[model samples]
Target: MRIKKYSFLLLALLAISFKSFSQDTTQYIVANRKNSLAQQNKPYVILISADGFRYDFAKRYNAQNLLRLGSEGISTPYMMPSYPSVTFPNHYAIVSGLYPSHSGLVNNTYYDRARKDKYLMSNKAKVADSSWYGGAPLWVRAEQQNMLSASFYWVASEAAIQGVRPTYYYIYNEKIDMHNRIAAVVNWLKLPPSQRPHLITFYLPQVDHAAHLNGPESPEAEKEVHFVDSAVNELQKVVKTTRLKNVNFVFVSDHGMTKVDNKNPIGIPAAIDTSKFVISGDGILVELYAKNKGDIQATYNELKKEAKDYDVYLKSNVPARLHYGTADDWHNHIGDILLIPRAPKVFNLWNNKKINPGWHGYDPTVVPDMRASFTAWGPAFKKHLVVTPFENVSVFNLISEILGLKHTDKIDGTNQLANKVLIKKASKKK
Candidate 1:
């Protein structure tokens, strides 16, 4: 195990000088690219994300397909997402091995002081722009080494970060049915070895939409969980027709959802002065960006004075363990002042719009409900294994190890997860 890791680590680092672009496009491809002969033979990985799937959803909803597959492989009690466990940040964290703060995606919608612009998840222009993203995402790393990748829709998958997007990918769209999506994967697998994707990302959004619209405990949420379970079972069965070997599935969720106190939500804090600071964030958390750095302390103190259901802090004092403080904000995009509400309470900035019943974006360390789910099943994994909860960043290490792709940059994740869940042979390249 050590030998394989050491070999990958010792190789001369690669220096890339190419440029790429990603606009409002779908069924995208990077022309003239073919997986290196060495990479064409690597084991296949289908990384699927069932958004808002709680750790216990399968068992609670009796998702027999997922339960059986998980029992046949490895399932952790739960996987802790990074602080402020929201979709975009945590999903990007999973692929990049960097916390949301480190990755510069502090929230689903955040203002970058340097760029003087806000990146909203709803804005397709910003979503497709690679400049907002940081760190070497899994697809970027794979392509850097000449291994092709594909994505059906996941955070940063559409952006051409580091001048590389997945070789085959579609921009985010909800219109595609499960039948067509599975067929696309099947077709990709049937491609010639050199043209086939070694790494593919497939996302399922039904669970999250239901959980957010109706409370996670509601019938609609439970129905979506079953839907995802049946969908995965169908996907696996269809892929089996190809009779291909070494196809692995890492079923995961970005973050879990919990019922919040929407009826009596906290309004915008009186301490915030618009002239002195710019504001961002929503019900789960509120961020105040100070126009002048010296004003931060006073605002933080004032917010603390009026603070009731929420906790206020200067960016410098954000919990060190959460890696969200000023020191850890690699992209300088984090707000100067942050307000984190206690669970069941969320910040209502406008004091007008109705808040959702189910919500996330709390520190997972303190709110267990924010924790996500993870299960590894396939030819590359050891049979019937269970391990303790791990951080979402650890997934970056696991994928690289499985595909024998070397990472030239430093990452927050380590080989600990890969070593524990993957069999020894996983480290040895085919």
Candidate 2:
């Protein structure tokens, strides 16, 4: 009887110890997961692009939210866009940290020699095709480092570049109401810590579209400006309700708009033979690809005759300031000769002409209308800071720094150049 009792006691003790050990192990795992979640929830960086919002538009219309952001954080008088100051090229430059030359998106619509394909922004398939895009966008860099990212209509965000995309992305839909877009972004911010995205990008096109239809200074454009401002106000309210910590906000524009009078259209010089080249781009910037490589010199000579009206140059002779021409093994998609019409002088390629009221794609240096808006407000930036005018390419580096992500070395932006706007520079040391 004594032996049996001793055996029973030993069995009971072993069972109790085993149960305690199992409970401890489970608690340890749960604790580790919680810590992991906290780590992943680091600070949030939200990049917003208000297409065609000129630098002066905010001050002109007394945009309350934009003015508040400018006073509270960092604001630049204007952000210079890359050459061919248009939509796709500049937007991609802002995200990829590369010039249009390096990103391979020289124009909104261009012909790719390798695939024998033409890429058009209107063509959804081509827009989503990874091959048409080059360089690492901000979202791609975030995902490669095991960080979460999301986008709501950001340029190039819809494409699965390098076979990877943001954790959450929606297809480009123009009909989606602006309020819905803002609500969706706010919802992403409200996700549980573990599911939250560290980086998010949202695009608002109403301002740009309005500016396109009506001149930038028109009342129609002002209404659209107020519309975007209201959306920003809603975003600010939603963000406060979440009580989220360490969030940064960046607002930018691809390029501004310039008035183009349809009644005063300038026709292409008859000296230039249309049959000798394949032309791409339709507005202020015209790209002419010679049918034969040998004809490049002859094409340049012919176009040079009318040099007073347009700045004409061969690909090799393109101004160094433009920073165009392909990098790496990518084909040179820019035309053999580029014809940039002087501002207020619009290009009318068609023999039959009609009026196009507004346009961009002008030389950013000379034309103030081509300068875009840039404002950043957050814990990462210095309060009431007014920075000198800088190019949009530096924006990519600024965003990467804010998100604490590693950027590809092939980028043209320098961290030092973009760091001028930040409050805590040493925070990015790691």
Candidate 3:
């Protein structure tokens, strides 16, 4: 009996030792796997912006390429644009991590009396000024982190903002060949993984061009959206079938278009003192350069009282709900006051019988008119997941999450979608 008891005690001690050793080994393995995953999950992020694409239009017009991309990954069903709901303001909002007002891109064209200059983001000269741009784009941020970055045709790309330039970019070519654009991107991806870009932006203007030329509902517009879809599909094929390695893709648009039934004039040429406000190109938006500080409110109130055909508000009086940055540097580029008309109504300054088809720049609060198209796919995204009613600011947060980087600037968005979709559940909880 003594011998049997001793034997049992020895076996128990050995089993206990083995159990502790096994626990230690399991913990180490788990930790190492997590570390490995962290290293492996760094993704090459691609941002695709198909200008003027509406939310419902994607499904209504049967965008098979977009639908297929969604089927292969995750998408936010209907993403709304920033206030004013114009392409320039909203697209600037996405990459800069700021709203239109905060980013100093309140409208496509706005007046600034301080420098006695008119700021148009499309103007290469205006964009060249770093102070004019509100914040750093992801490309500049990536460069700061010593990661490779490039842009195919994003706004402010040609500008030297934040003292950083993309590794590769086009010079705002309106007549750029789509195939050549795709080939340039593919060539960049073909570089060695170490030298390859971590972030890239692809802008497809054909759809937006077609939409503006042939109305968003026209068969020509449908064909344009499909053309973009085909391009996106081609990109998918290149990324999937190649040795490009780990990657992530985000597809988005600046704003949706609305059909106009009336020639609604937001402001009359006779209403504003023409000497004070030169009707800028494309009368859809106007810039008022105050001759002096005293002239600011006068110009503002005059337009407000007389331009009843539009909704006029001062840049200083911009709605707090929009979350514009309060810094002094950002305010100068904004007009003393902005004018935007209600839907089915467009600003009358730019009415050229030659250039009418479809348009944007309506108030963002109007839901049906404000909705834009967006989708995210690839290894970093969850397959076939649906996210609804997220804000445009959420995009910045999502991109930061994919690269395993953190941005402390308080934005209107978060990385909740990534956690909801991409993060894998632990088999057993800690």
Candidate 4:
């Protein structure tokens, strides 16, 4: 009788401990998910994003590990960010193969017309609400096909997009140490084949945070760059312990950063009537969401006339290459008028005494400094190959091709990028 009682107490204690562990991890694991037989044998991909890591960061900072790894496989001169060159938008673009305008995450902060709510990156509630997001991210794509995925951190990765989240994901937080973050990914790789994740996304925000706090070229930002570089190297070393033969890595940045003229920031345009138009955006890009449809034309005309240093454009007149105008605004998140500032100058609606010296959110085509970085190294990629610059949207197609996942959703990325970087497969994935 005593033995039975002791065993019951032990079991209860174990259950309580397990629950405690799960809560500590802050991980949300979907129940009863296992990769399909075909998916089980597919190659593994770990997509890493270092926010605000510029195209020249590796070379400029001498990130030896990254330079060496990039050389081991395929890399590009630079990767163009989707229109608006901001964080939330471009990160979603890389995973979803849809430009931010098309995906509804048109900016770091955008006002959704239909719902009449704002999606601010800093608002924890909105950032986690899946309704604010649309594009079928890579993890969502993999989960739909019964291939498990994991995310250390990625925009919208915490949200359940299309009724699915990565099989193993954490509600993004900065508390976890970089070493522990990489360990979690390694642990995912060490899981049993039937339950293991085939797709994983890891994000590092140190570089971006430092760059924003101090100019991108500042010593503080450079130290963070080296930290990220070493972290990537450490992750690769840890991943090898799993001995998973086909593990692949793709390193990229959401957008690049630049030093802006924060001392003499431009105030809200004199022509803008706050009551008539809702203002959104930061630093380099300013958007005007008109309350009344009729007000758009008149307001745009006024802003265009008074515009100095910044160029004003009607949504329709925005350059077609940006894919961000009325025609491309699939969810109507874009404003009727866009105010684009030349580099070194940004808008300050709040009339703040000072703003951060580093900023992005510019048109990459115009401000070459806004180009993001991309490099891929794996058994699947060609070795020591350099390619021309490609749009960030194409990263989605490249990973999709690698995992052999078929995406029925409409996407802006083409298979051309995957073809150029990836090696010809000996046999198609079943």
Candidate 5:
């Protein structure tokens, strides 16, 4: 009889211990979440994308603050980019939940010389025309569902290229107005809870700018990261004080940078007759629009076969695996062919500068070329968890889950994976 009683006591103690552990884990997750004034709070989602941010740079620089979020929440081992892995292409992927090809943006710029129009990324005359865009971005989707959304500096945020505009948006300008852009976001959050957007996006371009000029590991790049980090920390403080505890912030980047090797020049003489084609932009990649398609094939062919130092392919033949498909919308409409130079080297045709320090747009498949990092922390996530390799599109699916919105089309990513980032699993299933 005594043995039976002791066994029961032991079992009860074990149950208590397990319950304690479970509670501890749950508390840990909540501790990281911003506190709220009310018992029930609306969920919030914030996405911050840093241009030209590479994955390993986080480790190399000992980004403890960033790693803390990952350790406390879920993080992707390596997130692949959409084909062409450039800023515009991959940024479109993050919000649309589609790869670059499907999103209709293939490169930074596209040339429709035949129509006498060039698709450059400026706010001047851009519109949310249906022809140039594909699928809906997170803001558009949220707006369709009658939810509020906002964007700071995403590529399409300025143009409203798809009939979907954020509740608030800013014109894209890196130097003229970046802080004001961030201020607008904070101001929106200060509005009444009902008026505040459930979804918000913010972009920082300084890092990419420094990287392009000084190389990825240069002192300028370090300063850019730290400056951005300070800004992010400030934003976090604001969320905690405001009634914005419901917000779930996600920090991510478009792609990483590779050092330029100026040793060998892939000599494809300028194909433009100057009278027929116009060239724009400077650096590793040059944007050109030709009045004649005939020259495009010859120029493209030579770049592919003879241009050993560069990986050249026409818009149609861009590798499918990159999720960058043939031209279907405005994003992919311009470039007839893309020239991606390998690492330790970047292309230079436009002013033909002797050497360029840094570059992106390489095939993401090059393991060393993959850039960017992702972190999330909030009630909507699964805490202290590690997710397997994921793609930028997954972020869209995850946001949908947090907001309880439905996206009808099939996307490359899923909320199921993102859920692993901020929430804690119960010790025992109910």
Candidate 6:
């Protein structure tokens, strides 16, 4: 009997010891997680792109939250998008820090010579194919450095570029409402320290879509501006409620929009046969690919003479300021002759009778309508900082710096431009 009692007592002692060890292990894990989070010192960087948002729209409309962000954070007079200034190229450029020329996404749709394939944005297979996208995107860079990243609806996030994707991403779905998008990001931010993303990208296309359908000055565009602003305000509220630490917000646009007057459309000149050249792009920028390489010069001469409201140039002779054809592989896909229309005018290659009311894709340098907006607010940025106009390419470096991630050496953006908005840490006196 005594032996039986002693055995039970021994078993009970073993159970108590195991329970204590398990508790200790759990506490150790919790402590380590806290320490790990504390050691990370890096801020959560939120990149928000409002497509087709013109720089002047902010001033014209009463975007309360947007204006408040500008007043509280670093605001630039404008951000000049890379040439072509289209959606896909500029969005990719903002993330990759490379010009569209070098990035191999010179236009929204282009032929890949090596692959002998055409890429169209509307084509789901082409859009998701990683081969169509070049240059290391910010998400890939973040993951490579062992940091988690997420994308709500950013371009190229759908593609598994370089066999890497953001730690969490959703395929582009336009049907998803604005509230859901903002809520999804907020939820990601609320994850445990180990699972939360360091970098998050959100895309709001309502303003751009409205701007494209209705002119920038129209009530439709104005309503979208307010809608997007409210969405941003909600995001700020969610973050504030969650009490997230060291979070930064970057607001930008891929490009702007311009009103296209259908009453006076610039039609393709009759002197040049449009059938002979493979035409790509729309609106202000047109790429004419010579069917026969030998006929390139003749084509250029004809285009120059025929085009009244536009300037025509060979790929090699495109203006240095535009930086359109600097890439080595430009000849593979770039048009033999480029056509750019003067501002407030767009090329009408299609003979459709229906009036297209609004458009963009203009030369950003001379066209004020093509300029995009940029604002940065967070712990990392200087308060009420107003910076000189800078190019959108610099955004990549700014994001990399904010996330404490290293960018590839081939990038065109310099750190000097991004430093203008960053808070200067006080130096210790010698």
The residue-by-residue lDDT of candidate 4 on 1-430, one tens digit each, is 0122332232222110001122245777888999988889899999999988999999999999999999989889899999888888999999999999899988877778788776777666777799988779999999988899999888888788988889998876677788889889999999999899999999888888788879889999899999999999999999999999899999999889889888887867778887787776665677778889899888888888898889999888999989989899889899888999888897764445357778888889988889999999988888999999999999999999999888886899999888987888711432
Question: Can you give the TM-score per candidate against the true fold?
Answer: 0.93, 0.87, 0.81, 0.93, 0.78, 0.87
Residues 1-430 of candidate 3: C-alpha lDDT, one tens digit per residue: 0122332232222110001111111100001111123322357788999888888767878889889788778877688888667766787778876777677766665555566665654455665566667767777776666666778767677677877777666566545467767777777677665556677898876666666667778898888888888888888777765565567788998888767643444434344564455333233444444455576687776666676555666656656655532343256665554565555665544222233547676655654756888888877667788886676867877776676555665555666755775645211111
Candidate 2 lDDT at 194 equals: 72
Candidate achieving higher lDDT, 1 or 6: 1
- C-alpha-based local distance difference test score of model 6: 0.74
- lDDT by residue (74-115, candidate 1, tens digit) is 898999988778888888999999998888888877889988
lDDT of 6 by residue, 115-190 (tens): 6566666556677788877788998887777777888767788788998778777766665667777778888788
Q: Could you give candidate 5's per-residue lDDT for residues 319-420 as a string of tens digits?
A: 666554354433534456566565655544522335556667666777455556777776667678777767788888777767666777767776666556
Worst 10 residues of 6 by lDDT: 16-25
Candidate 3: which stretches are off by over 4 Å?
1-41, 262-269, 276-289, 293-308, 323-329, 351-355, 409-412, 424-430
Candidate 4 residue-wise lDDT at 413: 95
lDDT, residue 199, model 4: 93
lDDT of each: 0.83, 0.74, 0.63, 0.84, 0.62, 0.74
Candidate 2 shows a clash count of: 0
Residue-by-residue lDDT tens digits, candidate 2, 1-430 = 0112332232222110001111111100111112134336467888988888988999998899999988899898899999888888898999999888888888777766656566766566777788888898988887777777888767777688998778788776665677777777788788777767778888887777777777788899999899888887788778878888678889999998888765666666655665666666665777777777787787678668756667887777777778864332244777777888887876665444354577788888889899999998887887898888998999988988777778647788778645787767523422
* Residue 7 lDDT in candidate 1: 18
Give the poorly placed runs of model 1, Cα more than 4 Å off.
Answer: 1-26, 427-430
Q: Which runs in model 5 stand beyond 4 Å of their true positions? A: 1-42, 113-116, 127-131, 174-183, 270-305, 312-317, 325-338, 422-430
The regions of model 2 sitting more than 4 angstroms off are: 1-39, 325-330, 350-353, 425-430
lDDT of 5: 0.62
Of the two candidates 3 and 5, the one with more favorable TM-score, higher being better, is 3
After TM-score superposition, the amount by which residue 18's alpha carbon in candidate 6 deviates from its true location, in angstroms, is 58
